[model samples]
Target: MLTISDLDYRIEARPLFDGASAQIASGWKVGLVGRNGTGKSTLLRLIREEVENPTAQSAIRLSQGAKLGWVAQEVAPTDETILEVVLAADTERHALIQESETATDPDRIAEIHMRLVDIDAWSAEARAAEVLMGLGFKHADLARKTKEFSGGWRMRAAIAGVLFSQPDLLLLDEPTNYLDLEGAAWLEGYLKKYPHTVIIVSHDRELLNRCVTHTMALEHLKLTLCAGGYDAWLRLRAERVAQLESQRAKQDAEKAHLQAFVDRFRAKASKARQAQSRVKMLEKMQDISIPLAERTVPFTFPSGEEKLSPPMLVLEDAVLGYGEGADILRKVDLRLDPDDRIAIIGTNGQGKTTLVKSIAERLPLMAGTRKVPKAIRIGYFSQDQMDELTMGETVLDHVRRALPSDTKVAQQRAVAAAMGFSHEKVDTKIEKLSGGEKVRLLLGLMAMEKPNILILDEPTSHLDIDSREALIYALNDFKGAVLLITHDVFLAEATADQLWLVKDGAAKPYAGDLADYRKLVLQADREKPDPATKPKTAAVETKPVAKVDKAEQRRLASEKRKAASPLKRKAEDAEKRLTKATAALKKVDESLAQPDQSSDQMQALMVKRGELTATIEQAEMDWLEASEAYETAINA
Candidate 1:
């Protein structure tokens, strides 16, 4: 359990948090949220006491015997092996092993060994390895030195260490920034079963919704703790704001009535005493102010001057990957119409982004050709593309520079306004901007380009909820084709019209939605073979299916039709009878449900309804049997 009371933090003179108070229940998964720079991270730091300011009463109080674990944001180079660092997080086990190794006395050694056994130190290595694997690290990478990995991969190692530690309180910040959707989903599942208090600071809404039990928002220089997940927090926050506005309105109306009474009789003698009383009441009333609603970027992609004909893009038997690299996506044939909105989804490192790049013609195909018009214009939104923006520059300067030199100041102002920047914010430096703001500025610039097709890769990684909603609205109404690669399941489900599954060196259409795919993935995981009892086999190579000649195919088709004709007829007949029986039962039940019906008539109807229901049940069973027979006949 953690309790915060009268928490305050300041920088020099400016106050970040003042008189903020919150109570976090034990074993709760909390998601901390607020606009950028509203001290969400500061609160986390205060809870962990990482900040320099120190005071007893303002400090976070944790119950006795509770352990806390936090993923360090800056995971520097170290001499320790990656796996060793994770395993070392089990301090008791590590210390016991060390003491046991050095102890010459049999009694002391035996005591230390017993402690190790009680702590389950024997399987620590395997558990750490498993966590590293889930976070996209290979078994081979486990023995490697921590300094060998890039910063992003090291951040993943930090997260893996925390998970392996299994502390009473676990803190994570933007845990999904280094994880793909598959890895993030795996982490989500792991945390759901974790019997510990977890507090996460992340922009990944899907992660928040999946793992968090409560939300702690730092807003208006105060803390608002709410029950439920991110969406619930949003609902409660809006309600709170609405309630404030309602009270403000009531206060305004009352003041107006009081002032009117005071004004009408201020100069008259007839109601002098009442006027004085009303004036005094008005003077004593405190002013109530309503906060402005949160404003999000309202920009949409510019419509192309004219719609292109169908087949805006086509890739024939395309092989996709980097230069001279073995194809990760092979023999892919895809066609995109002007109206196509395809979302590419797959596990991490399965080449979803590679497939997207191939479609955008940004990557060269090893074989086959991309058939596209020379005049085709693409507006691509990759997270990496944001790096091209000049740092230390203002958002307005970037947008204006992207436009024509001849574009008027009025038009530029309109563009900035559409990008959620007002006159004052237009000059805010890019270096000082939040992740969401920078991404919004980049997107606003892209939308101003008026391209014929938009290809986005992980577009929602840095966006807040309001900005994500705005992007979804824009994408849904976009005139040209859209090809998106995103980990955001909600955005994919809300915007994409079709889904492309990239796996096993191939890309193809998925005949289901995100929900269906998730179920299949979970079922597959549940059905995975246990390593202890799994049989080992050599990898088998598979050849492409052979094609048959026209005459042979015709003959086979004729045989299949002849075999299936009778069974198909039977199934069709059963289906018709089932429909009729169901309708008859429905009518009888409706007659029996009428409130004004006589008891004798109702009794007769009930008996008839029961008989019809039995008939309908039989028809359903017959239909199922006939359908199975038809399937067997067709296969045979």
Candidate 2:
């Protein structure tokens, strides 16, 4: 459905894409992957631009009339309900339904009905609700105004709309960044079954492996599309790299043999011709181009020199919340030993954050006791830690500030360097660093004191796969206890040995793995009642009434039919007008879609389309009022 050829683009005089090319077929889910700063987002932008404005010279090209969809931005706060916003995403269905309400021509009305059936328009609301619910929205949230949601929730709503639209070509860039673990898992399943073509830019390894049918790797300023998922791509890339190494090795040996022969025989007149020929042969041989090995800096979380005793931190019967009588988590008894590696898993807003904060001593307990040894040191990493960093300061400045006042400058620089900051990067300002770099800086600062207990909240949200792997390694090698709260299931599965589930206002141990929790989440979403299909309770009558005579009933019916005839005729006339207006609007739309139209002609057609739409809307109102009057008269 999409083809990109010779895509050469530059940013600030630096090459991002140099002759990159790829072709993706219809209904294939492709995961676009690369390390940070590799221009994955830039490539998406180029595709979107090509879709919006096709040109003869453009490198990116999409199938004709294929609708492109993406979460362009978070949904702005508005008075419209979340469900309403999603239902309106299918613009064609919305328009057709409006037109059908007042269409009087029997053939035209039947055609509209058939089209609606083809698109499954009648069940649009239920589908939209399902998408919303899968994204962590409650059933009641469907009726809530978009303005009532926070920024993150609004971003979910935006995602719901695009998914509900079901465009032919869907583009997603780090979609799980705003979701919790449950939501991300739900999205992973949804994409696996998505019918249309999908191109997602994500760093979630599980998602890349399980959801996509192919992997598109962006490396060395080039695009390589491989069959199967991320793991498959890795195997293929490894084989290719090995082949290049073998060819290069063979070529090197041949060159060395020729050189040795040339040196020994060049002065001897008997072998002079052969020596010169060997030199010519060496020059004619082509060198194999092997890519340089990529180096990823490892993350460091230093452990304290003094070994801490067991039960480093403990919370007993704790009621955690923001204030008195406002407890979010109740009766929580948990302990973190020096060897404990615990992961907190639950749905969003289930007090996971509250429990972590309470344990970290960031939030005071309303009731209950939290005990920690006087020598115990706790290192906490949260998204808010990034915000706490000074924008005007450099990486070196933050690292030095976290150290003791008497610590040497050389020691501080060494610490920063260990955190992946180079000499130039150490002096770079915080405001200019990317999200991943900022996370590294935060982790570096947290490691300064060499805390024995680490409480990390969604630490891998901004990290790429390589960095995430590095983090997993660091966490595993560390001697301190780890309490991790992250949406990345892979990281949690790799690092945490114990699972603590936060649910129903309590924190308790879970006896299952991440896969079990995933099943539970999906099952809960399936069990949620779809409002559109829910059965309504009917009122029962308590009193009985006598029946009227047959003759009187017939006379009353006759009078009612006679009284409704004129109103029915008026309704029919309004329907005819609506049908005509809708036809005119369709004609205008077709005209607008034609290529190479004069500017003035295009403007005039757009104006006509608007006017026709307004006319149809007014006719629909008129038809509805007349039809209601006819029914009322007949009932009377």
Candidate 3:
């Protein structure tokens, strides 16, 4: 158990936390969330006492003899075999084996028995192997040198090592980063049953909701601790935003009233003193500045010609795998349309990546009809995008290379601007681009190709919030068909119109939202509910049990039908408001592009732009609220 009291942390004179206090008690699993530079990692390190000179006013006190295990963001694999690394977790096993080999007395046998019983060694080695295999290490791979693995695979190995430690407290930072969908889901299930304390920093909302019993949000120089997961946090944050809006309106009204009084009594003899007093008081009063909320990225795709029908891509009776091997994905029958925004999901090493690769044409499909429609130009973004960039080329140069025809340098600059590259950033070398920047560059190049179809594999994995939203918006507006492979459930739920359940080395289509799919995937997580956090499902047994099941079912069905009508109306209303705001932003874009815009007209347009920006922001907030209400109603 860890107790953080009035904690304050700083990095290079930047205050990461101020008076932030939270308790991580026994049997607690917390999801620590914040922006990239907000110091979630630093906070974790401070709590583990890995950082020195922590604030005097703050304290992170852990129970005595607490064994801590951490998976740091930057993972380095030593020159040991994977098996050797995993076997290292079982120190008792090694010691016992040593003593068994060299024992000179029968009493030593007693000592060995005691030690084996103490550490539960009879089953621990097998369990460790099970865990490693579950995490996607082949039996052969267990003997491979760790240094030979790629960065992502090495990170996975580090994760396995940490999990094997089975410490009292676990700290995992972006544990899902290197994992495929299947690997991520496996981890989700593992964390669900883990009995000890866990504090995870992750960007995967689905993973957070699956494993975390509590949410800790770092914002505004403080921490907000709450029960439940991201959904609960979103709801609470929305309510707080609403409260701030109300306060802002009240403050504005009071300011207007004070100004009106001041204007009326500025020159009047009797009212002058009262007016001056009011003015002085108002100036001294803390100016109630409205809270500056996060700004959503404004984005819409350009229009293109629509196909006569949904751009269909069909895979028939497919047996896909590498040469002379069993099909990694076998006997697959699938149809994809423009309307089907499918998310390929499964556990790690279960062939999600292989399926994506086969679809993207990066890998050959051994025995199948891979049908792609004519005029379907596919823009495939994958992990290989990082490898495709030339070592010496600038970011701008790489993007320009994607252009089909040789274009003037100025035209390439225009293309870069459309993709959010500034002049200074344009000159930056491809080797120097950050992960997020590389993603942007790849997207910009894809946009230039004017693809009628897009295949994205783990596209959102490296993107920050702003970039993710922008990419989502682009995908939403795209007239072309899309086939996506991602572990981000929120992204899928928000953007996908349909779902694909990838399991048992194949893909199957499902007609449902991501929430439905999530319920299915998480159903396998059968951890016992914490008694401290469990809520009573219904009123206690104060009334006799009713046994009229048929009548009760019919009554409930009738009530559900009755409830649907009004809920539909609310959904329609929200959709209409969102439509109107989207149209207005489009109009602003059109107005700004006018060729003959005069100086005075431009000034007016700027004022109008600000107003429209604020209106769109409010509309988005309202839309989120409305959509949530509609979803809740439907589920209820």
Candidate 4:
């Protein structure tokens, strides 16, 4: 549990949070949503006590015995192997397990057992492995040095370490940035079953919708807490916006009515006082002004009449990767159609980038017969577009460079305007722009080429929610063939019409829509147990057959109920009764602590408490066995 009261945060005389107050209840999963530079990450830092602000009042307050764990957007790995660093997060638990393994003396074993009672090593190891696998790190990769891993892999390891720590409160900043669809889906499921409270600042819409119980929106230097997920908040917020619009309309009508009355009765003596009072009231009322917002981002692709035919781009037995015998991709085959929107997906370092690079002609294919349509123009936007900007050119000059034939100032201005760059921003140097600004600029320039084939490699990587939505809208409207490789599954769902899964080395194509891809993946996942071990629960999930009907649901439910035997059921009932008795004992303790407690009542409460304590210990043992049996049944 955490609470912030009357918080006011300012930077360089600009208010970031003004009178912001919210309570994050126990087990709350919050999606901290906002635009870029709107202080989402700053707010998380404030809560984690990594940043300080003098203006903020009544600093973050946490529940008793709360531990904070954070996955920073920018992570720096210390000198250690991936496994060593992750294991170090739970050093005490690992130490206990190791000591138990080496213990030979019975007395020492007894002492270790007593210590292990407080921290369950079996549960901790299972949870850590689950997290690591979910993050896309294989057991073989765990022993690799952190320094040897790429930036993205290092970030993943850092995230895994944070989850391993199992803090009471988890603060994740853009957790899905470097993850593939599989990894993101794994994280979504993990968060759904996670025991502790979580607060995440992310631009991934689907992840937010799937994992969060609440949406914390930051706007106008204030915080608004809404129940339910992002979609629910969108619906309610739209209604509120409509209400404000209606109120503003009424104010305009009232103002016009007052003016008409004044004009009609100014000369008449009878209504002069009333009309004047109306004018005073109108002047005194607070103005209902519409809020100023960032202009709607332009969404349009270049209008090209050239149509592409089947096999727009082909790769025959391609082998890709760097260095000798380090084959990241092998024997890959892919075909592109005129209107096919292919989404390349795989876990990190599985050649997603290598494939994208080879396809985009940024890198040479190691050994392959690749073909492309004649005179096909390609527009490519790399992940690091921000760093690719010219140092001296202004934004306007950059747009002009994108169009070599367009010489007129008006035409250049129109192109700049279409990309949401206007007035002073067009004049600002490209080198001075922010990451999001640079992305918009790159996209604007790319649109000018009007290429028949588009290659966007993680275009939404550094973009804010608004910018990403804008880009998705533009891409959706483009009729040309596109090869988009991105980690954001929601963006892929919105933009891509087809999914191309890159597993191991080869590319496998899937038909149908986004939902079909999800169904396929889910069904495949159910058939195979997760490679990493996870804690088994009593609740059973029904596996969807070809036709998901009521009969299947009933059959699955009946089977699950039967799987939990009578012995397990009886033990569960006994545990429930014991928990109720324990609550009653706690009430007895409270009553005895009262100033006006009677001696007879106190003596009776003590007797009941002692009996309840013994009963609870026995119930716990029975419950543990029953739980183990229930878990086994579910896993089976």
- Which model scores highest in lDDT? 2
C-alpha lDDT of all candidate models, in order: 0.78, 0.86, 0.71, 0.75
For candidate 3, lDDT tens digit of each residue in 406-520? 7888888877876767888898766456666777777767766667667788887666555666677778877777777777766776777766766677688867766665565
What would you estimate as the lDDT of candidate 1?
Answer: 0.78
What lDDT score is found at residue 586 in candidate 3? 68
How would you encode candidate 2's per-residue C-alpha lDDT over 401-489 as one tens digit per residue?
Answer: 88889999888888888899888899887755788998888887887778899989988878989999999999999999999999988
> What clash count does candidate 1 reach?
0
Model 1: pairs clashing at backbone N, Cα or C within 3 Å: none
Using lDDT as the measure, name the better of candidate 1 and candidate 3. 1
On the 0 to 100 scale, the lDDT of residue 461 in model 2 is 79
What lDDT does candidate 3 reach at residue 455?
A: 77
Q: How close is candidate 2 to the true structure, as a TM-score?
A: 0.82
Extract clashing residue pairs from model 4: none
RMSD of 2: 13.1
The clash count for each model shown is 0, 0, 4, 0
Write out the backbone clash pairs for model 2.
none
Clashes of 2: 0
* Candidates arranged by TM-score, highest first: 2, 1, 4, 3
**Which candidate leads in TM-score?**
2
Which runs of model 2 end up more than 4 angstroms from their true locations? 50-57, 101-108, 407-410, 525-527, 531-636
Quality of model 3 by C-alpha lDDT: 0.71
